[model samples]
Target: GLSLEPILLALCEWGQHHADELNEMDRLADCIIRPRQARQPAIA
Candidate 1:
């Protein structure tokens, strides 16, 4: 059987390199959406 270790390792490396940028974008999205969401009424 072929091993997936190499594929996973490459993905991990890619994520590590972009982690900061990814986190920053997530933070920005939360900041932007949360406040706006708070002002809106939720539909049940």
Candidate 2:
């Protein structure tokens, strides 16, 4: 199996440096995902 700690740390550092872009992407992803989530029934 692959070790994820270093990968996640790198990603965190990258995110810190590129938060604005990440936020924009998150907003875009939410726009795309929300509609599908809305159409689906809530299940627990």
Candidate 3:
């Protein structure tokens, strides 16, 4: 498997340099993981 420590470290550095972009990326990831309709109960 590939080592992620270096990649994560780089991401942290980048995030520090570009906080706003990182925040936007986090928001986009949240949207992707939890769409609006996901909050509703499924109708069986």
Error at 1, model 2, angstroms: 7.0
lDDT of 2 by residue, 1-44 (tens): 13555676677666655766656545332211111223667799
Off by over 4 Å in 1: 21-44
Residue 6 displacement in candidate 3 (angstroms): 0.2
The whole-model C-alpha lDDT of candidate 2 against the native structure comes to: 0.49
lDDT digits (tens) for residues 6-28 of candidate 1: 67567666655576666753433
Across 1-44, the per-residue lDDT of candidate 3 in tens digits comes to 13555676677666655756556655332211222333668799
Off by over 4 Å in 3: 20-44
Give the C-alpha miss distance for residue 43 in model 3, angstroms.
Answer: 52
Q: Which lDDT values do the candidates have, in the order given?
A: 0.49, 0.49, 0.51
TM-score of each: 0.39, 0.38, 0.38
